[model samples]
Structure formats: structure tokens, C-alpha cells
Target: MRNPETILEVDDLRVYYATPQGDVKACDGVSFDLRSGEILGLVGESGSGKSTATGGVLRTIGSPGRIVSGTVTLDGEDILKYDDEKMRQTRWQKLSLIPQGAMNSLNPTMTISDQIADVIETHEGRQPADALRERIMTLFRRVGLPERIYSMYPHELSGGMKQRACIAMSIALDPLVIVADEATSALDVVVQRVVAQTMLKIKRELNVSFIMIGHDMGLMAQVVDRLAVMYSGQLLEIAAVRDMFARPAHPYSEILIESVPTLTERKPMKINEGITHDPRNPPSGCIFRLRCPHAMPVCSESRPDMVEVHPEQLVACHLWKKDENGSYVRQSV
Candidate 1:
């Protein structure tokens, strides 16, 4: 059953990049949802299409890349069908983005306050200077930034502070959904934790939903309510964080979890052993079959649809089948 609080739905999304050889399927048939006030983490190795998928959702893919097919429904409206002006208006008002690098996202010539104020003015029209100042300051306080840094430039603030400032800017209009693309990746461990905590705090206080993209399983474990595993332009699995860590349903998910280093046990890294196929010419069947250890003959003949293997856990793999009791069981190769 779909949650009543579902705020965003991405269905059958396919993003392709143009090349002389052919169209590279960067995000192929990916689907997921973001419920109100929930933090959903999109996790995968590099080139796994995490960023490309989100870029498609945000309608920011540049030339040489395009959304081949998809429906990005936000608040019951298909944002993919929106025009340029409508999307520009919708951005930062209904949906906002906190990019990967805060320093690169911010303007070096403007102060922190001015940058945030510019977003407000551009969207809501001009505001009283005094009221705008107070509003910006309140946003800073909400994100754990100090007032002393309001007049400072991007270079003046530390990496963490700049990220928090970006967070503040993202929420200036109280957008219903925020796509945070590796918002904390460039920070140190301590700062990463701090920024993650700030994001959680914002979620709790403002009832905002988030789609965070990253490669850090540890941080995702700490912050995200659910995890979505992607590989070679396809989503392999999505489940509650606890359910995924305890028993991942897909072979790739299992290998990804095992690849995480633990203090209590040491295991050989199995994530790097598989051979990756060219993006321009992916295999005909399952995209992961080239690297999957449990590859079956059927895996080479057909692509598997996502199936509910357990309560609220969905996986796309050829190794699981429904029994007479209607429960998913591992199929013997």
C-alpha cells in the first residue's frame, strides 16, 4: 500500500547521455518515493547513477544529457511536464536543492545574508530590508550558524559552516522537498556528524522530506530512515535501514553491506571483484548480471522486476521466487 503521506514519486525514470557511440543509459527505469518528513538515502558506488537520477528529478541535466522518460510527481503534480517558467517558479518554492559542494554553489562576491536574501527576493518579490534581515538570521539560527557569519563571504566560512549556510538557503521558502546531493561529503568526520544532525533537526522541526545522495553507508545508517541501493543505472533494492542492514534481499545489496569495514569482524572486500560493462551498451537482461555472483541463466535472458521479498522491502533480482505460501524464498542455482 502506498503511504498517504507520500510527498514525491519517481516512476520509470530513464536519463540518457548523448555520445558518438550511442545514448548512455545513466539512469535506467529507476523508481522510488519520498514520504513526508522522511529521509531517504540513495546509496551506490561512483557512476551508479545516483547523481544522474537526482539531476533528472531536479530538471537540471544539461546538454549531452536528457530525461528520456519519467514522471516526477511532487504533491500530486507531474513536475516533469512543467514548462521552463513554471519549473523555475516551482524550484526553491516547492522543491529545493542543496548541492554537493557548498563553496561552489555559493557566490564568492556576495555575503551569506545577501545570497539567501537574493533567493527570497527573486521568488517572493522584494521584502522590507529589516524583515528580510530577521528572516535570514532566523534561518541561520535554525541551521546552527552564528549571526557573526552573516556578513562573511563563502571563503570566510569553514566547509561545515558553508554547508549549513546552504541548508539555510534551501529552506528559506520552506520547500516541501529538499534534494541534498552529497551535502556533507566534503566535510570532516566530526563536521559531517554535526551537519547530519542539523539536517535531522530541520526535518523534525519543519516536517520537511529529503532525498540525500551519498556513498557513505555509515552516515546513511545514522541519518536516513530508508536506503535505496543502485548499480549500473538501476535500483537493486530499497528497504528500511534496519531491515537492509540485518538482511539485504539482493546479492548486490549483500555484497555492498559486507564491503563496509567493521571493528568486530574482518571480511574480504567483494564489491570490487566484478567486471563493469560499458554504459553505452549494457547487457540485454539484468544490468548487474555481469558482476553478480549468483547469476543464473534466466538472469541473462530477462530483466527482473522489483518484487516485495519481505514486509516493506523491495528487491530486483532473479535469485528470489514466490513459494506456494506466497513468501519470497531464495532460488537454488
Candidate 2:
């Protein structure tokens, strides 16, 4: 059984990619706490390294990927040192993954029933198909898909149905923590809403914590309790969802929230240019200083430490500092 108190905690996570050119620091010093029933949002641009950090949690980091340093504690126990024997047991049972691009993960040739059956079979401890089939049917119902989908092949399912099936597969084990890594990105708005609804339903019904990794702030705000902002390979801000959207502390987060298209104008907010593409070579001092609207000489010359703004908010910016007279000071660029 999983602990109801702390579901997952990532401390000082560092994931690097050893490439021919140089070591690319995809995730450096990433840390966060995931409580039971809490949804944590990982928001950032395309190459912000959010995916790599979560991927490392489940030991799913692809070739040349390295976890270099950090401790991933699931239910107060370190999971980084888990043996393959233990990892095989913990992967789906304790923590599950609903990967991005569901279309690519499903095998077109196999029927949905067989595909799901294969996962249960590979995991061990799960019962035979006869006993599991009924559960599979119920999973389909939970995800709002018809039970008849069990017999259909991957090629027979629509995009949304396939996505739902992937979710069903991930949740079959009833993991304590579910990492939905951009699970809704490929769908249309209607389907995205449906998926989000299903996710909420799953969370409520299963009492599982979530680490929702995606770039959609509005969508994330609707699902997660807190949002963690990442830039290059660093976490710039961590705050309550409402606080993040209402008043972001980090310049990078502010820029990201601003980029979200306001319904009034319908055009997305434009952020100032410049993001280092090559992860191996992030800029000196503050990684976001080059694009930060509030960048100061101090910001470009030294890295700002993570400063606690409130009981529940943490930010990495020199601007949140106060003057000796106890007045808040907003530094100039």
C-alpha cells in the first residue's frame, strides 16, 4: 500500500545527456514535492527539460541519458537505488506513466484487449485474461469508452479513443503517482476537455497524486494544485496554481503566463526573444537573464538562489528582495 501523506518527492534532480559534442544538462537541480491527491504542473517551453526529469523518475530515460545526481523518494523511500528486480515491481504498481503521443505507443496490429493484456502479463502478479478482461471493460467505462473497444485493434480506434486506452492501461495498476507527460497535447480542444475531465475523475476516484507535464498553463491551472516553472534546465518558480496565474514571481514564469492567449484578444501574449536551444551550453549566471524583462546586472553576473516568497511560494529572482527599511524592491533591468 502507498502512503497517504507524501506520494512523491524529487530532490536536487540532475539529468544529463552524454552526447558527442558535450554533456547536455537537460535537468539540473530540479526538486519538488507531490502530496496525495495534489496535482503538480510542470510548465515550460519545448526544450525546457521537464520531460527528462519525470522520465528519469521511472527509470525510463532513453539511451545516453544520465541521472548524474539527485534523489527520487516515493513514499519517503529512495527509488533511485532500486534494483532492476525492485524497479520492475515498483514501476507500474507504485508509479505509472501515461506517456505523450499515445498514437505511437500503441501497436496498430494488435487488438486493444491483447495490448492491455500484454502489459499486465509483462508486469507479473496480475491475474489471467479471464479475470482481468472484466476489469479491462470497467476501465473502458471509466475512461468513457465503450467496453467493445476491447476487441478492436489499435488501427480501429480514433485518436481520442487511443488516448483513453493509453490512460486505462496506465491506471490499470492503480499507482499512487500518475505522471501524465503531455497526454492531451495531440487531441482537439473538445477531446482535450474530455481527457481533462477523465483525468479529474480518475484522480478523485482513485485518490492518486499527479505530476502533469505540459506547456498549457490554462489547462494545467485547471488540473494542478501547484505549478513549477522551468527554464533551460532549472526550476525558476514554484507556487500555488492560482498564485502562479494571478501573480507569477519568476520573470520566465511571468513571460510564460503572458504568452498564454487571452480570450479577450484571442492572440497569445508574446514573450521577449532568446532561449538557449543547446542544453549543453546554457548562458552564464541566470539562465533566463537573456530573455528576462527584469534582468539586472546582478542577474547576469550571478545565479539567484531560490527565495521563499510566502509559505507556499518559492521563486528564483533577485527582484523579490527587500530594502533595509522593509520596503519591497523591484530591481531594474
* Best model per TM-score: 1
lDDT of 1 by residue, 1-333 (tens): 367999999999999999999999989999998999999999998899999999999999998999999899999999999999999999999999999998799999999999999999999999999999999999999999999997999999999999999999999999999999999999999999999999999999999999999998889999999999999899999999999999999988888888888778777655466437888899989999988889988999999999999988999998989999989998866
TM-scores vs. true structure, each candidate: 0.97, 0.93
Clashing pairs in model 2, backbone N/Cα/C closer than 3 A: none
Please report the TM-score between candidate 1 and the true structure: 0.97
- For each candidate, what is the lDDT? 0.93, 0.84
lDDT of 1 at 102: 88
lDDT, candidate 2, 82-184, per-residue tens: 9989988898788988889998888888898887777777776658667888878888888899977878998888888899998898888778998999989
Give the Cα error of residue 84 in candidate 2, in Å: 1.7
